[model samples]
Target: MDMIVQSLRLGEIEIPEEKLIYMERPVLGFEDYKQFCLIEIDEFKPFLWLQSTEKPAVAFLVVNPKIFVSDYKIEINSKEIAELDIENVNSVETYVVVTLSDKIENMTINLQGPILINTENQRGKQLVLVNSDYEVNYKFMTHTVEEETEVNREVPVEV
Candidate 1:
């Protein structure tokens, strides 16, 4: 199952065919792409690239919502669950699209729209959560290391 893909980050690389995830419904803004591969870079653990197979330049940075918000949850309709052929809830894998910025602290995660995948069937769908408390610009990192360190060093002056 050796397949080569022209990736924006890795140039041309070989990937396993089975690793490709089929998107039944296009991701919100990326309706043109129907197939994508989840590439994991060791340097960026808990973060991965959802690279489109149809278009090399199209890619997205995604992460598990639970990493930052432990209570993150998604409720999908039965029709969607049936479309993915998902039987057990454990078979589904969820991820939120992340928008990175020059300033790490300003990075945001799209919680309202989550990409749900049926690992067993290799099928995926980007679902919009209805009436969710989550936001599109949920600050992923509220404080930088320097800021945290500076706060820790602060000492109250004598009253």
Candidate 2:
């Protein structure tokens, strides 16, 4: 089954129907749109576009939080699990929305609200972690500016 989506970046593209993820509840701030497709691009490895099926121009950049935060974890209660029709916990795929900035250094990830998808059922939900250590603006990269350098050259030093 071929599905067509008016992608924000790639104009129109054909995707498989099974590839579309159905959200039991709308993602935060996007209440009207529930169906979305995860589009992968070679240039954006480890990051994919969550394109809304209802709104062609609506899309989000999402990435697996575990990639950067190795200890990242979200505890979903039985209610949420059952809501997504998730039979196996291991089958859940987690992703966090990425916020890009004019300065690459200011790029951040919304760790507090992570999207959990049940691959088995293609159902998903954006969950807000209660009492989580994560932050909404978790910087993708941290840099420290050195007042003085050996060559006296101003370079953004990554910490």
Per-candidate Cα lDDT values, in order, are 0.80, 0.80
- Per-candidate RMSD vs. true structure? 9.8, 9.2
- In the predicted model 2, the residue pairs found to clash are none
Residue 24, candidate 1: C-alpha displacement in angstroms:
1.0
- Model 2 clash tally, residue pairs: 0
* Clash pairs detected, candidate 1: none
Best candidate (score: lDDT): 2
Model 1 lDDT at residue 155: 15
After the best TM-score superposition of candidate 1, give how far the Cα of residue 19 lies from its true spot, in angstroms: 1.2
Cand. 2 TM to true fold: 0.87
- Global local distance difference test of model 1: 0.80
List model 1 lDDT by residue over 66-143, tens digit each.
767665777777788777888777777888899989998899999898888888888999988778788989997992
Worst 10 residues of 1 by lDDT: 150-159
